[model samples]
Structure formats: C-alpha cells, structure tokens
Target: MGQDAFMEPFSNLFCDLQCKIYFLLVGVCSALKLTVPPHTIHGIEGQPLHLTVNYNFNTTASEVQIIWLFERPQTNPKYLLGSVNQTVVPDLEYQHKFTLIPPNASLMINPLHISDEGNYIVKVNVRGNGTIAASQKIQVAVDVPVTKPIVHTEPSSGVVEYVGNMTLKCTVGKGTRVVYQWMKNGKRLHAGPNYTFSSNNATLLILPVVKEDIGNYSCLVSNPVSAMESEIIVPTIYYGPYGLRVKSDKGLKIGAVFTVDIGEAILFDCSADSNPPNTYSWIQRADNTTHVIKYGPHLEVLSDKVAQKTIDYMCRAFNNVTGKRDETHFTVIVTSVGLEKLAQKGKSLSSLAVITGISLLLILVMAFLFLWKRYQPYKVIQQKLQSRPETDYRKAQTFAGHESASDDFGIYEFVAIPDLAGGSRVSSQSVPGSDFISGQDMLSTVYEVIQHIPAQQQQDHQQ
Candidate 1:
C-alpha cells in the first residue's frame, strides 16, 4: 500500500507533464511548424536508412536543441541521441548505429538490421526571450531481401490425361514479406476452372491434368525491397492421338489418293499429335483383303513392285497410355501416264521441228527465185556473151558513112534486091568511095586476110 501510494503522485506528475507537452505541441503549430515527410518507411536488412524532420519557426532561434527518442510496442520511450547548438551526443551503446546532424534534426542509421524497426521521435526546442517547441515522428521497418526461388512439381514422373491432378509449389531459401506469382510457358497463370491458387500464390493446383496443362512452369517472388524467380519445371501429361494424316514426298496427292509414276519409289509419312508419341502402322488392301504390312512412321512403296495397279493404304496411330487410336485412308494409284505423256510431247516437238525446217527451206528457195527474175534479161545477155569464143572474130571493115557529113565523105549505097523466079537477087554490103562494090570482092578480101594470119603464125613456129 505504501509503494502504491508513493507511485500515485509520480503518475499524476507524469500526466501533468504529458498534458503540458501536448498543449505546447499544439500551440507551436501556428508560430512554429514541424514536418516529417513519408511518415512510414520500409528498409532492407544490412542496408542504411534515413529519417528526416523539417521545421520552421516565426521568431529568431537564439539557441536550438534537438532530442531523438526510440519506442516500440508496450514499452517506454528510450533516449537515443540529442543535438545542441550544432553538436551531437549519442548513446554509447548505439553510437555507431545512429547519426544526428544538428540544427536539422534528421537521423541516419547505418548497417541497419532487423532490430532497428520501430517508431522514432524528434523534438525541437528554441530558447530565447520567447521559446517555441515542435516535434515529428517516423516509423521504420527492416526486412531481408528475397532470393532466387525454385519450383517443385508433384508427381514428377508423369500423369494421365483427364484422370490426374497436379500441384506446383515455389520455394525460396531466404526472404521476408515475400510474394509469389505463377507462370506457364512465359505467360502469367490465372485461377480458372482447372486451376486454383494458394493464399499468396505460392502454390498452384490443377484439378485435372490435360494436354493443355502440359508446359514449362515457373514462379516469381517479390517484396518491397527485392525479387526473385524460380527455375523452369515441365510437367508430363499423356494425351491422345489427334489430327492423324498421311503424307508423301513424291506424288500428286488429291483427297486421299496419290498418283505416282510407274516404277518410281514413293515414301509415305504418318503422323499425329500425341504425348508419348503414337505408334504408327501401315495397312495394305489387296484382293479385297486388308493386312498390316509395316510398323513405323514411314513406309516405302514401289509402284512396279506391288502386284495391284491401284492399291488402297491406311495409316493407323495408337496412343499406348491413353488407349486411343486414329486412322487415315489413302490410295496409291500406279500409272504409266507420266511416261506416255512425255513420249507424246517428244513426238509433237519432233514434228513441229520438221515442219519448221521445211518452211525455212521454201522461204530460201523463193528468195533465190525473186532475185533471179529481177535480173533475168541482163543475166541472159551476159551468159550469151560469156559463152562466145573470143578467137573466132574476123577482122573486117563495115561502111562508116555516118562518121562525117555525106558531102565530105561519100555515103554508102544500099542496093535493093529484086526477086526472081529461079533464084534470089543479092544485096551488097561493101565499102564505097562513091558507089557500092560487088559482094564477091568484099568476101574474098576478108577470107584472104583471115587465112594469111594462120599461115604467118605457122611459118614462125616452123622457124
């Protein structure tokens, strides 16, 4: 009872001091103002942080003093540091952890750890004839940064399509206040009919697995200070044999039929979209009977090797896990039409070449005839002259009465011949001094001149 009675007065005195400080803080707002921007701040562990206090006073500050205090949950405020007239005095135990620059009551905490998270208080008092006081408060938080995350998948071996459930989890070694995001095939995953997320998205659940759910998955974790991403994880899911089809490299394919040249080799490819890839089988229909001829994704068919001219083929795909199957039907039609068409084309080309050659020959002949007819008369005359023997000419003189005037040079007389009953009268061609001369005389003169030249050439040869 005595101890309780003694503490009552001290409690009342504390209440009185608190009331005065509260009134003083309210009163100084008009004359002096205090401010702390960002009343709350978050910091990373092992990093530095700063808490600022801004103030302004209407009157001149003769002497200024600043005090800093630290408080936590359900605990009395403790003194950390103070400044007077541009000088700082900090607690010895925390001298290295806290800093104070006087006149501007901002605090700096270096190498901040988790223990530094708390509320901090600052008080400013100016002393002179008239004094005013102001104060500001700031809350600080420290956290450990997030690290690289890793993803883990349940039933890692595999899962059957439409009959199994899958779960994905994200794990990290070191972090505080971490968040998680799920991703598949580089796209953000969303909660849907087939998917559900845990509280923080650290875990993803797939109700029932399907082919659509099979993909590379990852996780991203983040916090205020740091972020991290997980490695990729691929979940195996067995599915069906879908979109089955047959393909060939060398053929004219239309509908399900392929037309290949006779004696040519054709390769057929069978495929489908399935997990644990589909087992392929080739079927041949011959003589109204079907038989499985081969087992593979590829088949080689030789047109001439098969007995039938037109044969039907089938490609079947089976999924061993899903127990589903699919098939495609196609016909391999063997024909010699490719070769026959080529032969006909060759014949047509040969005939066309022959006709072209004949037409060219005719054109050349016509051009030659046109040139010959244009100069026919000149050509005939030249040929006649060229065919004559130059040595056969007899040296004889003809009448040249036209060379001078008729009075100066006597003109030649042209005598007309008269017809008779028994014989024909002769006309005379002779050189005339004044009148015509006898033909017999002119003829003998020319003959004698011609005979004399040969006789002179023979005598020279004999000498």
Candidate 2:
C-alpha cells in the first residue's frame, strides 16, 4: 500500500506535466496568431480612438471570428463587440460607441470618454481547425487637450534690481498630465543661482532681481495629446544708470574734451542706459567749486558766454527707483575755431595743421629770445651788479682813494647831477685829471670835453 501511494503521487505529477506540455504544443502549433502594436495607447477626450490588431492564419477557414473586451484594473473583462466573418455584433450598451468592420481584429470607439479608458483585449478565432484562437491586450489612456497656459507675476508694476524678489506662476484651465517649461526670448531656461522652480516646474522664483534677469518670459504647457504656449510677458526690473556719457551737437569731440568755436552755440545731451529714465543734471566745476547749472538732459552753452579758456563740466544721471547714480566728466575748450573752420573750407590744409605750425613757430621765437637775452652784454653786466656782495659795494665806493682801482678801470657810465649853484657836475668816483681843477671850473666842464679824453692820456694819468 505504501509503494502504491508513492506510485499514485508520481502518476499525478506525470499527468500534470503532460497536460502542461500538451497546452504548450497547442499554443506553438496554432495557425492563428494575433499581434497588437504599442501595448499602451493614449487617446484625447471627445476624439475617435483606434486600437489596431493584426492576425494571420495558415489554414483557410470557413468562418472567422473577432471578439473585443474591455477591462479596468482588478475588474472582470466586459464584452465590447464581436465580428463573425463580415458581420459585426456589438454589446447593446455600447452598440453606438464601439465599431468593428469585417474579418479585422481592430476596434474603433467614437467620441471616446474617460470612462472608456481601460485595457482592450482582442481575440481572433479560426473555425477551420476546430477553433484555433489568438488574443492580444492593449492599454488605452484618455486625456483632455492641454489648454493655452497663462503666466502671472507677483508684482505687476515693477521690481528694483538687487533689492526686490520676483515670482512667475503658470496656470492651465484644463489638462491631464501636463508638463511645464519656462522660456526666455525663445530659449529654454534652467534653474540658476538666483532662479528656482517648483516641483511641477510651473512656478519660477527669482530670489533677488538683477539687470541681467530682465527679458520676455513665457510658459509652455504640453501633454501627450497637445502642446500650447502662453503670450509673452515682460517683467519690469528697475536697474542702474549705466554707461553714462555726454554728447554735443556742435563741437569737435576727442575723448572727453569738446572743442567749441567762438560765438557758436553747443548743445550737450546727458544720457545713460537705465530703466525708469534717469534724472539728469549738468554741473559746472570752476576754481575748485562745483554747482548744478541745469536740471534737464540738455544744456546749451554759447562759447562767447564762457569766460574761461577751458571749463570742466559734469553730466550726472540718477535713477530714483534703483537708487543708483553715475556721472561723467568732460572739458570744454573755447577757441577761434570758427575762423579756422572757414579757412579750412575746400582746402586741403586743415586748420589744425595751421594751428600746430603757428604754435611751433611761436615756441621757436620764444626760445630764440630767451637765449639772446641770456648772453647779452648789457644783461650780463646788470646781473653782475645786482648780485654783488655788500663788501663789494663798499669797495666800489672807496674808488676815490684808489682802493680796488684796477677793478673799476673798465668801461664806466657817466651821469650829470644839477648842483645848488645852477650848474651841472659830473658824478663819478674819480676822473683822470679832476684833482687839478677847482670847483666852479670843474663843474663848468662840458660832457663832450670830458668824454673826448684819449685812452692813452687816461692811462698816462693813471700811471
């Protein structure tokens, strides 16, 4: 009895294995085969849905049958429609919804709804070889079309650079499984140091606004069925007064210096790159003092009205919202450029070249005059006399006693002084023969007779 029980268990196991082998052979040798591409299919609400299936049989069949079933998760399959040869029979509840044409295993659903979204099972049965069957399952998903998205900013008015934060949120009216994307000037944007996004990528946050963050922004929402983009929106970002400069209408500008012609009216415009247009001020600096001369962007100055040859001016730009300021300094030189310009008309030689030549000529003349004056005999004598020491002046005064007589023996200048007796006397430390003469006669001597004395006779007298 024990050996019989063991044999009985082995027999049951052999039978079970034979049954499994029989079924496997049947599945492999079956003439009918069914193929359904794209196991998962997506469908839009209110749109026609098609589930495609292809079937083939090797043997010619007297009758062909195609059956379709619908099932949800953890639910029993429900019959949708079936076709025998060329005749279609649909379930009474879904007669108008499901459609299937002749001998084909594919099924169609018109105006598919959310409730119709489920797994679809198609079966093909051939009646020639005692009902050879093949089946395939396809999953269907229903979604509403993605609507156009709209973006809204936290502060609609504006935000200041580096002082305020900004937020952008995207919203959709109707959609399922919608994805969000941020775009700036037609390019996709990603999270950065100051930029962040929500989990669903619908909201964008700018921690601190800056000048580089200003641009046209938009939202793109898409689903498996449709895609849409919102209208462009520009966020106002108050920025600084950058690249400040001054421009003149009528002047020759070289770097920061503007050369203006005499009697010409020059208009200066102060400008800068900024948001919320900057307030401008024109300031004039002279004699180490500065004062605002104008409040507008434009300043008109006549060259004749300027008293100085060169004047310093400043252009200041201030942004009230951003609380930033920038300034530029320039110089205006008044010259007789009007006449020079007139002379330059239709002439190959520019006025600048003429001015340069004249300047060089003047400098040469001045140098020549300085050298000539430095080496002149008269100037040399004057400089020597003025630079003499005090003791030298005392020695010169003692020339009447013949002290330092050799030093005073060079050329001498003569002068006459009127005396109290109404006659003129020769003023000098000493004369060659003056000691032998009395006072009235000596004083009466003519300047011509004294000057006519020969150098030989003077030397002889000196010896």
Candidate 3:
C-alpha cells in the first residue's frame, strides 16, 4: 500500500506536465489562425500619412516587444524604432520626426518628406510562459498631392460667329480618378445641345458660339482627397455695327452751314454710332467735280481757300463690314468781301445781259439821226421854189398840174426862204409878181417850181 501511494504522487506530477504542453500547443495554433499577412501602406509624398501594423496573439500578455524596420529596393534593412510594453524607443536619426506608441502598433510621421518612402518590416514578441514571435512586412508608397490644375483653351480668346468649335482642357500634375467640372458665372454647366464633355471629364467642348455665349468661365478639378479651382477667364467676342447715326463735335449748325472768317481755320468733326468705329473721308465739290480732300474723323479747311461767295463740303463715312455708307453735306458761305466785287464790276456776269442792253441804245441813236437827215432834203427843195419869177411860175404850174394828180398837199408845210446876200438883197421884189400859193397847195407848187427853175437862180439859192 505504501508503494502504491508513492507511484500515485509521481503519476499526478506527470499528468500536470502533459497538460502544460497541450496548452502551449493550443496557444500556438490559435496565434497562427489570428495573425494577419503583411500589407503595403499608402500615403501622399509630402503629407502626413499613418502606417499601421496589425498583429494577434492567443493569450493576453502584459509585456510585448515590437520592432519596425525599413528597406529600399537594393539596400539592407535599417532599424527604425522598437517598443516594449507601453514605452517606445526610436532610432536617433528619425526620432524627432517619427513617433510610435505601444499597443497600437502604429507609426506617425509628421511632415512626411520624400526620403521616408519604402518597404517596412514589423516584428512582435509576446512574453507569456515562453516568448512567441510574429512578423509582418508593410510597403509605404509616397506620392505627391496634385498641384493646382490649369485649364487651357484651344483658342485663348473667344471666337467670332460662324467660326470653329471651342475646347477647354483641365490638366493636373499628379492625381488619380480625377473629375472636372466647367463653370460659368459661378453656375455649373452640363453637356447640352452645343456643349459636350470628354469621357475623363477633363475636357469641355462648345460646338458653336453665339452672341449670348459670352460670360466669365472657370474649371474645377477634384479627386477623392482634394479639390482645386482655376482662375476665371473671360473671352473676347467680336460683333458688328447694327445701328448707326451721326454726331457732330459742334452741334448741328443751322442749315448745316459752318461760317468762318477770312484766313481762319475751322475744324469739323463727324462721328457715327456703330459697333466698330467707322472710317471717314472728307469731300469737296469744286468746279462741278467732287474730290476727296482728306480721310479722318476731323476735317480742317482754311478760309482762304474758300474765296468764293459760297462753298459746299461733304463728309462721307462708311462701315467696312456692312458695306454701308453715309454722307453729310455742309455749306460755308463767305459773304464778307467776295460778294461785293462780283456785283459792281459785272465782269463775270453771263453774256446775255450785256448784249441786250447795247442793242436797245443803238436803236435809239439811229432813229434820231435818220429823222434829222430827212428834213434836210425838204429844205433844199423849199429854197429852190422861193427864188424863181412869174415866167418860171407858169412853167412850174404846168409841171405841178401833171404831178398834182398823185400828190397829197395837206401834209406839207414850209417856212420863208432866207436870202444868202448879207440880208439886204431884194429877192422878194424879184419874185413878187409871181403868185406863190399860200395853202397846202403851196408845197405842191414849190416842188413843181424847183423842177423847172432856171439853173442860175438855183445856184444863187444854193450859194
């Protein structure tokens, strides 16, 4: 019975040892099932991104050891930092920039720079009964955040009507899964009848541009992480002159007359209301011909050139696009000294007036001379009849009787004939016995007497 008791104690001790071994094996199996494989960490190149290493253990342990390592493609692994229990120890090189807290199995990098990028390894050991080890490798990929996107238009300026299409492309330095949105006047725009968006949402197209399409436009670029906007761009649109009118620098003068004194220079301006400024040409009408003097909005004419009594000038303005033209006519009348000279001299007057006046004066003078000459012929006949005697009177009677049948004596008159012999000659005594008719028949008798009178007496009367 004493031997049996000693064997039972030893057997109990052996059972206790087997139970401990089974428990350790079970713990190992559970740890293998719960542990996670290594994974790569992702972060932006110039921004803070956390790197986490997850691990599992079968039993809760009071103290654990964690070590983090880093390696490049062709370089050896470098020890970064380690943690025991709740305390962390970091490599002197990166201690100030990188931080680690135990139990979390995570690492934080402040102001992550490009140099801290590569593959990382984490080794963990749980202290319970005997130490158990677990390890995982994580890859850290550092990338740069996308820079401010730029939107470029095919033709930076706006296009005219009936021109080709317009395109806007949004460009970013570095980004993934980007989206672009086009905005006009702070409103989002969608693809419509004339607008189309590209597949990647990076480009926007406007098929045709109309007058109403002018506005402030911008492009917005975004990703899951960040968004950026471009500066506003305004495009120029060209149009035409629709309504046109004239405006003079000096308001419209009465009758459109610009009066200036002699030797003075005057400026006349012509302006029209149009989309594009109109071209102007100054025209002057001289000697029945219209000529272009100058081309500009303003025209200056020296009064000395306008010596004439009245001068007329014109301004012609035209639109190249519409091919429409307008003209304004103005007259400058120089009434000071020019009109006076033209009137008094009468030198420049037409020929018709001069010819008519000379003709009337010549007719009046010729009538007076012819009337005076007609009486002379009658006086000579009267003198010849007064100087003859009775013997001649009978001869004259015979001639008178023959001519009296056709002569009208009532229209004839006579004055006494004067003696040419110093007023003392008795021509009356010589001719007293001859009966000279003293009536209308006297003129008939006188003409008859002159035809038959002797040549001696006729010569005495003519002397």
Top model by lDDT, which number?
2
All candidates: TM-score: 0.67, 0.68, 0.38
lDDT of 1: 0.75
**Which pairs of residues collide in candidate 3?**
45-143
State the local distance difference test value for candidate 2.
0.78
Candidate 1 residue spans exceeding 4 A from truth: 1-29, 339-463
- lDDT ranking, best first: 2, 1, 3
What is the Å distance of residue 6 in model 2 from its true position?
A: 39
Q: Which 10-residue span in candidate 2 carries the lowest summed lDDT?
A: 441-450
Clashes of 3: 1
Q: Residue 248 lDDT in model 1? A: 86
Candidate 1 per-residue lDDT, tens place, 125-196, comes to: 776545566666789888899889988889887888899898898999899889899988999999999999
lDDT (10s digit) by residue, model 3, range 1-463: 2354335334434644554575577645245221333565556656787776577777667678777777789976677777898888777887887778878787788777667778776667676755556566677766555568887887875565446577888888877556788899999988898789988878888878654566788888776556788888765544433343233332224557754556656677777754246788988898999999899888776767765857888878786754667787888764455433344335566678778888998999999999987687577666865665644554443333333423422223334554575332212212323455543343565454445555654444335
lDDT of 3: 0.64
Model 1: how far is 209 from its true place, Å? 1.5
